[model samples]
Target: MKKVLVTGASGQLGKCFQKIASEYPEMELRNFNSSELDITDQNRLQQIFSEENPEYCINCAAYTNVEKAEDDEETAFKINAEAVKNLAEVCKNTGTVLIHISTDYVFDGKATNAYRETDVVNPINVYGASKLKGEEYIRQILDQHFIFRTSWLYSEFGHNFFNTILKKAEEGATLNITTSQTGTPTNANDLADFILQLIREENSEFGLYHYSNLGEATWYDFAKAILEFSGKIDQVTLNKSGYYKTRAERPTYSVLDKQKLQETFKKLVLHWRDSLEDLIINRFRKI
Candidate 1:
C-alpha cells in the first residue's frame, strides 16, 4: 500500500482530504496537525520523513491570516515560505512526490481576464508575497511536484466566510462586505477530491494548476448567497461598505483561468452556486 503524509490535518482542506481518503482502501494515510508536526522544525520534519518514508507529501499547512500577516511578517514567511522550502528539499532528497497548496493572491488582480498559471505574479501584500516565494522554492527544489493555486476557499470544518456570515446572521447582525473585490469561491472538499484524483492517476506531468469552483462573485454577492441559502436572508442586512479596511492590500479581482486544468484533466469543477447549495444542504442543514 502506498503511504501518504498529510500536513495541517486539522485545517478545513486537510480534513476534507481525510474524508476523501476513506474511499481508497489501498492507500495508507498519516495525518499531522501543527501540534503533531511543525513544518518549521527542520530536524523533526526530517525525522518523520525518514521514518514514515511517505510516497507522497501533501502540504496543506500555511499561515493564512491575510490581515494579520502584515504585522506577523516573520511568522508568515516562516510557515508559508521557509517551511515550504524545507518540505520541498526533503521531498526531493527522498524522491517523494509533493502536492503543495497555494493562493491566487500571487497575482496583482489587475488583469480584467482570469489568471492563468503562466501569468506574471506581482503580489501586492505580505501574504501573497510569502506564498509566491513558497511556490518558487518548490519549483526550484522538487522535480516531482504539483503546485495548486486556488482562491477564496471555504469549508464546513473550519473558519470561513460562509460560517462567519451564517453566525452573524443568526445573531441578527448586519453584514457589510466589499463588492469591488471579485473571485471564485472554492470549496475545500472539491479541491481535496481533485488532489486524490491526481494521485490516483499518478500524474507525472507535474506543474502549477489553478483549481476553483466554477463561476465568480464579489464578497458582497457571496455573503448574500450564503444568507439566502441559510434561510437567513430576512435576518441579514446586506450592505456594500468600503468602510472595512485591513492592513493587507487585497485584490479587486483574482479569478483564475482554469483552461489548463480542464485541458489536462478533461474536466472542470462544478459551478460555484451548485456546490454552494450542496454544501449548505449537507453541512448547515444538519446543524
Candidate 2:
C-alpha cells in the first residue's frame, strides 16, 4: 500500500479525504489533527516525518478566517506561510511529494476571464497574500510539489457557506446573500477524490494547478441552489442583496480555468450546481 499522511485532518477538506480514504484501499493513510501535528512546530513535524515516513504528505492546515486575518496578520502568516515553509523543508529532506492547497484569492479579482496558472497574482487581502507566500515557499524549496489553487470551497462538514445556509433554513431565518462577488462553489469531496486519484495514477505532471467545479456563480446564486436542492426554498427568505459588508476585500470574479486539469487528467469537471445537488441529496440530507 502507498503510505500517505494528511495534516489538518479535522477541517472540512481534510475530513472529506478521511471519509473517502477507505475507497482507495491501496493507500495507507495517517491522519493528524492540529493538536496531534502542529505544522508550525517544526520539531514535532520532523519527529512525525521520521516516524511515519509517508511517501506523500497532504498539507491541509491553514488559517482560513478571511475577515479576522485582516487584524491578525501575524498569526495568519505564522500558520499559512512560515508553517508551510517548515513543511516544505521537511518534505524536501524526506523526499516526500507534497500536495499543498492554496486559494484563488491570490488574484486581485480584476480579471475579465477565468484565471490560468500563468496569470500574474496580486492578492488584495492579508489572507490571500499569506497563502501566496506559502505557495512561493513551496516552489522555492521543493521541486516535487503540487500546488492547487481552489476557490469558494464548501462541503457537508465544518462552518462553510453550504452548512450555514442549511442551518439558517432549518431555523426559518432570512438570509441576504450578496450578488456582488462571483466565483465557483467547489465541492470539497470532488477535490479530495481528484487528489487521491492523482496519487493513484502516479501522475508526475505536477507543479501548480487550478482545481474547482466547472462553471461560476455569485454567492446569491449558490445560496439559491442550496435551498432549491434541499427542498427548502420556500421554508426561508432569501434575498438578492447587491453587496454585503465585510472587513476584507474579495475578488469580484475568481473563476479558475480548468483546461490544464481536464487536459492533464483527461477527467470531467462537474458543474457547481450538479456537485452541490449530489452532495445534498446523496450525503447531507441523509445525515
Q: Using lDDT as the measure, which candidate wins?
A: 2
Give the per-residue lDDT of model 1 (tens digit) for 1-287. 88999999999999998987988777888999999999999998999999999999999999999999999999999999999999999998888999999999999989999999988999999999999999999998888999999999998888999789988998999778988799999989899988887787778878999999988999988888888887889997889976467788898889998999999987658988888888888875655
Residue-level lDDT of model 2, residues 112-223, one tens digit each, is 8999999999999999999999999999999999999999999999999999999999999999999999999999999999999999988888799999999999999999
Residue 139 in model 1: shift from native, Å? 0.8
Off by over 4 Å in 2: 284-287
Q: Which stretches of candidate 1 lie over 4 Å from their true place?
A: 285-287
Provide the TM-score for each candidate, comma-separated. Answer: 0.97, 0.98
Would you give me the overall lDDT of model 1? 0.91
Q: What TM-score would candidate 1 get against the native?
A: 0.97
Give Cα distance to truth, residue 175, candidate 1, Å.
Answer: 1.1
